[model samples]
Target: MSEQDLFADIRPYNDNEVAPAIQRLIADEEFIQAILHYRFPHMPGVIGSVAAPLLRFILKRKLAKLKSVQDVQRQVATFMNKMIETTSKEITFSGLELLDPKKSYLFLSNHRDIAMDPALVNWCLHQKGFATVRIAIGDNLLRKPCATELMKLNKSFIVKRGAKGPREMLKNFSQLSAYIKHSLDENHSVWIAQKEGRAKDGNDVTDPAILKMFYMQGKKQGTDFATYMAELNIVPVCLSYEYDPCDTDKIKELWQKKTVGHYQKSEFEDIDTIIKGIVGFKGRIHVAFSAPVTSIPAEPDDLAKLIDQQIWQNYRLFPINYLAAGIQDSSIDEVAVEQWQNRLMAVPDGAHDLLTQLYAAPVAKKQ
Candidate 1:
């Protein structure tokens, strides 16, 4: 069987399918609506109705000639550049030189925003002249077929979330492990979250199950666990956002989960969060790529803790984070704390403490 056949159900869209996927995405009404709203946010009345079709035509014409993933990435970089320039005061990087453009590594980053975490990492890689990584996206986000097609076009593979039964779950994890190994062997880098979902409360924790999944195929092949992990060249990435666009929303969700023991997301909640994360102001953003973990611990939980430590240690603590911790911390300047407090004056009464928790949790955990 062909190597590609192993990942047929979960692999990204190939070059041959790029044009068709773009066509399908442009033709999708939901996609059109989203573009219309995003491009013409203030003018959603007659102006939007008249401009949407023309904008769609222009976009289709521009995208029609793109033949490869790199072409799409070049186009994506345009928007990323603009967003960074306008939304962020400065974007910084650390340990990027550790990455070799000629080699492939599995990057496991702490998830924050629904989209921008991986997108920011991709933008950095692109800027550094490295080949973009194949992202692991949960199937839950692809409820819209157009969304799935678009993500696949950008070299994102499905993670088969919501699997039923232990056997099915194990099968899914096995396939996922095999795909990661295959991608790296084929010289394609892979990016996955350290955990299954975004850490909404600002505490970034690695799930041991994710680490165990990485060892599934290697264990089956009778390879030593530590050697297999080293072969994968696993790297931990820390993504820090000075001002999370969905800070309040995440805080509310976290609070609800803590108080009610569960929280149900709205149908379009992820979509809304994704949009906000992209277009919202991030202040100063930093992505740190740690050295590859060559000496993996024997236990998955130990490995998870090691990753967590790397992420926490490398995480950039912004002034807002310090302010969120409290005025007595003395780590942050009084002026900066006052500035953040003034900004929070506009936040609703109930959300203020939750928002503080969202930013302060990281600082508290690091301490």
Candidate 2:
């Protein structure tokens, strides 16, 4: 099969495919109910059910003009602008001006919030007149059909997280590797988390397995590891949130895993986390774009360390971090101290220390 055909199952919706995907979303009853629940959370279930048709009608009309991927993104940008204005105190970026807008990059970002990390990165690129990236989302988050459609419409490609066997896992990883290289070759950038899931405990460590996955296609093509890595233009991105919206949830999960030895996630927990990440208040946010990797390390472990160093060094430390780490710096004001204390009080006593350590992890890592 041709490369395009091979990646068809995983690639984002192209221009011609956008309309059909939008239609599918509009026609989906569950998608309409989700919108109603989000927009009118206090409404009775019966009332929401009754209003679903009207919601669908409104969506169909509002989305009818979105005939291409760019059109969908422009609509998403409007929502993003509103989200940033309301949810965040301020959003800032550094090192973006140094990069060439014409070149494509593989942005290896430290994941915190499930949705906001990539959304903020795309927003930064969009505001700076750079083309937004093709986001790499795991299939675990795409269990809902509505989600899959919405994500693909927003230029997100799937990463097969549910490969059943070793052979299937290898096949999926190889295809994913090929897809990233393919995207860069087509002058389209890609954004992927450094690890498999969000670093709920505030650590931003790059997994060497991810780096090795990037090398799979290179290995198949007989390209040396260093050369292939350099060719991919991998850039490390750091996303720092002053107050993580889902901090309490993360702390509870950590506490459970430590005390209970295991924690189970509900069926829709990821979806709930994504919603919370979007609408919840994030005090201040910063995105740091590091210089693309020029001198590539031959080993995945070494490359992981290099990426980790860039993320840690360039991370925009906030007052909350200092407060959590018990570092009495000038940046930690009375207000920040109160906020940190309030957050601690909000969680259970047993998890309070975990919450402190969660916010303090970055401070510790940097030191």
Candidate 3:
């Protein structure tokens, strides 16, 4: 559904809630063609030659008309193949056979590089015979050109900005929670960042707000948090970037945020950063997958803490990030700092500078 119709359907929604007559208009071939053309004015062969025709054929003639997950799996795999080519990575994934290909999962992950984080998870899921997961992407990035087009195609729905209006923001999250539950019920997975935005540096942390939102998803449904988490199959994913292409820009922004209380990206600048993050080479990057959250207390606060700890444990912090943080400030025990320095010294000289950038922000907070 488009952002407009989503606001209208604020109440409960079922699989058939998004009937073709209305939602189809939103996904109409003519409209998609126009958007694809607009976004890729210079590059049409991939979108027009393959994507446009295939998507139109499916949405128009095959969507609800088909019932098998096999069909969905095929489409998702092809889309991922394209994604692999588009993002250009030495993409390696583990924990491959743990999940049932057809069962749904709540894929919670650390937000490392922009754009690529969701894309990588989607790509891996596709390769493993799962349908593309619905994504939770913020409206701030959706305001731009490249980011907006890419995210939508990748199955992300909009999340309203804070300044939009307090009511509007909550309304957006409510819709998100509903949609996520719906996707899970339909045996389709959903991917969301642990935090709101991109990870500026290699160190990834879980945002308490994200856990709070997951708790909110099942609260009003008369379902307790543990039952909700168990049913949803919350799977944590860790994405490690050996080198952050946006390190300089992130440091610059970090400087601003530290010097002043605020910082904003120039129009389309975030897009540039995302592109660099995706294409950037991350050496010896690792993705650690945790078993799904099977057991938990019903209390929201307790559940939140459990989720936070799980996320932190999977966070793929490279040696550089640890070294940078450990060394950049001497107040944090010099002995411990020397340990990170020793570890950094051990990481091959070729990757030293990249590691330094990923870790050493020289700002109020470690990126």
Candidate 4:
């Protein structure tokens, strides 16, 4: 098969595919209902049922103008600007001066929030006149057809996570690795989380498996691991949120995992989490970009440690972190302590220690 045909199942939608995708999104009853529920969270069930068709009409009219991927991104950027202005107190970024605008990079970033981590990274790059990236989103999150449509429209490619057999798993990973290499070859940047999922417990460790997957295509080509990795121009990115919007939910989930040994999610839990992440309040935020890795390591484990060091060192620790770590000093005042205590009041007493450990992990890692 041709390269285009090989990657057709995993790649983002092209310009010619945008119109049909938008039309499908508009016609999808699930998508329309999701929008209605998100926009009018407190509306009665009867009212929501009545409003679905009207919501579809409004979406059709609004989305009619988005003729291409660039147009869709422009529309998203407008909403993103508004979201940042309203939900965040401040957003600071650094290390953009170290990057060349003409070069393509693989941005391997610490994952914290489901939607906001990449969205914020893309926003920072866009503001600095850099081309936006093709984000790697896992298939586990795309349980709905509408979800897949929305993600593809936003330039996200799927990472197949549901392979049922060892051969299928290898095939999926090989295709993903090839796609990443192909994107870089085409002078397009890409963003992928350091691991498969968000660091829900606030521990941002790079999984070596992720690095191995990244090298799959190169290994098949008989290239040295270090040489292939250096060719990708991998950049380690650090994203720090002073207050995670989904902290409480994350704390609960972690608590369950610790106490019950497993935590189960509802049918629409991921969707709900995505909505909460977007509309929820986040305090001061920081996105730190490190210079691309030059001293490439031969082993995935060593490379993971290197990436972890950069993320841990560059991570911005807030006053809340210190308080959660039980470090009382000049940096953390009585008011901060009181506020943190009040926040803890809403959490279950049994899970209080887990919450503390969540925020304290980064502080400990940095130290």
Candidate 5:
């Protein structure tokens, strides 16, 4: 098999196939049951029981027009814009003027809130007449009933993890590569994280292997893996949160990682975090769209390093990262990252929590 085939085997979003995909998600009883339990616990069971299927029946046929990916983009864009207009909530974005809807882009952003990282960016892109990018959802996330349905609706395809068979791994990666290429070739932008997983420490670092696999996927088709790399039009996106709504969850998870050497990964808990994060109050959010990186050379090592540096610039930081760093290291300047927090009328009470959670090394040294 050609290396290009490995990278380019991704199943493109087909209009004809969307209904079946939607049907599969809508009919998954576990999905319906979970959403009801989590989101509508107060409503009688009969409500979702009748509501889900009825809702499916009403919209299933309409998905035909959604066959054109552009149509889907417009619908999602319109829906997002309308939601924002009607809500009291607001998100101030900078650097979006840098984007070009006429060209396809590979948008790489930091992962903060489980759901909104991509949603917010897509919403902004939609406003600019750009198509919504296909998102990458971890295969582990499908284990949760509610998240599975939600992610698919938002143009996310799964990335399988821990496959035992060599064939399975190759097949999965090939398909992913193809999907990304097709998205760009079609003028639909792609959105992905820099690393295979979220940076729990909030220190944004890209894994070389992740970008390596990206180009390798299309090698099977005789596509100049180098050419594919060059065509990616990589864009750095930063999602800044004034305070992580789930800082407590992050701290608890880190505590587990340090003690157990590995934290359990599951989709249900992630779904819970996403739900709570969106509806929960966020003091401020900034989604910055940096210029695209169009210069990718063929050398694997060189290409990966180049991509890594670009993404690092966009890694969003919490105000507390500065505070934590300062309290831990008396030598460093505290006034740097904490400027935003200090300017506020009343900073979050959890600034102390952040210091304690993040500065374990210093605490141990003093002890």
Candidate 6:
């Protein structure tokens, strides 16, 4: 097979493949079962038994007509619209008008939620009349064959995190880097997390290794590091959630890792987190897009720090962050502290301080 075909299984669905991809998803019983569960979460046993087939029938009718990616996006928009209304008190954007809609950008963002970080960025871009971006999803989330298809159909390309050896890992990184460059060359925007995983501690730091990977493919083309980075039009995106849906889960994971030396995720845990992040209340959401970093430094470490500064500067703070930071220094207003204390009453005692630190870490870092 050709290079494109070799990476076909990992790439997003093309326009011609969209219809068949949707068909495959519809036929996947696991996918259908997941839809049934999400559609009728409150309905139990017998009701679920009846509702599953009914919901699947309705989905078949709806999905069968979705022949293009835009058609699928329209359907996705409905859920996103609902999510905004139900989860957020307000959803706002900044710095979007500074961008040229015709230009493709590499959006490097601080990852908070499993899915919503990039989804919110895509939503904002789509609303601004810009093309939505293809997302970078990890291989760990694609444990099931159908899971891979589902993500690809939704414009997610895989990053091979589970490569066995150093040689294979380097090749995967090269392919990933090349794919990102190719997408930009085709005038397609892309969304990738600033780091390999969510900064579980809420510190918006960029990993130098990720920056180095971006240079790998460009180096092969004999382009200078700074020039190659500038040509990609890298933009820093900051997504702030007033209330992270998976805050407690994240705290638990962090706590486990700290105490036990590592945290092991159960099967479907990531999927569960994704569902929670989508449906749970977020209070208020703000996404800030930084101007393209045209003057990148030659050193990966320096470039990483530059990205971190942009992300930290653009990150919007909510009331909870102030409350969290106040708990540390006692500088916050008494009235606001009291109000947040009452809110904290709802959180479990075990996770209270850790969760507070999670929100406060960003504020502290920003300072």
Worst 10 residues of 6 by lDDT: 327-336
RMSD of each: 2.3, 1.0, 8.8, 1.3, 6.8, 2.6
Q: Estimate TM-scores for all models.
A: 0.92, 0.98, 0.66, 0.97, 0.72, 0.93
TM-score of 2: 0.98
* lDDT (CA) per prediction: 0.86, 0.93, 0.62, 0.91, 0.63, 0.85
Q: What is the lDDT of residue 313 in candidate 5?
A: 53
lDDT of 1 by residue, 225-268 (tens): 88899899999999998888877677777667767899998998
- Please provide, for model 6 over 1-367, each residue's C-alpha lDDT reduced to its tens digit, 9 standing for 90 to 100: 6767866867898878888877787778788778777776666778777766776688788878888888777778888998899888899999998899999999999999879998999899989899899999999999877788778878999999988899999999999998898889889899999998887778778889988898888899999899888898999998988888787788888777767899999999989998899989887899999999977898989999998888888777876788788744444457556756765665567667777888888787777
Question: Which has the better TM-score: candidate 2, or candidate 6?
Answer: 2
TM-score of candidate 3 on Cα atoms, chains taken together = 0.66
The per-residue C-alpha lDDT of model 6 at residue 63 equals 79
Q: Write the per-residue lDDT of candidate 5 for residues 119-195, one digit (tens) a residue.
A: 88888776667767888878776665545545665678677786799998886776777677766887777788877
Among these predictions, the greatest TM-score belongs to 2
lDDT of 2 at 65: 99
Model 1 scores a C-alpha lDDT of 0.86
RMSD score of candidate 2 (Å): 1.0
Question: Which digits, one per residue and each the tens of the lDDT, describe model 4 over residues 193-220?
Answer: 9998888778899999999999999999
Question: Between prediction 3 and prediction 5, which has the larger TM-score?
Answer: 5
lDDT of candidate model 5 versus the reference? 0.63
TM-score, prediction 1: 0.92
Spell out the clash pairs found in candidate 6. Answer: none
Instruction: Report the error of model 2 at residue 79, Å.
Output: 0.8
Candidate order by lDDT, decreasing, is: 2, 4, 1, 6, 5, 3
Model 2 lDDT per residue over 1-367, tens place: 8989999999999999999999999998889888888888899988877798888888888999999999989999999999999999999999898799999999999999889999999999999999999999999999989999999999999999898899999999999999999999999999999999989878789999999999999999999999999999999999999999999999888889999999999998999999999999999999999999998888999999999999998878899999888888888888898999889998889888889888999888887
> Roughly what TM-score does model 5 have, to 2 decimal places?
0.72
- Candidate 3 lDDT: 0.62
Candidate that beats the other on lDDT, 3 or 5, i.e. the better one: 5
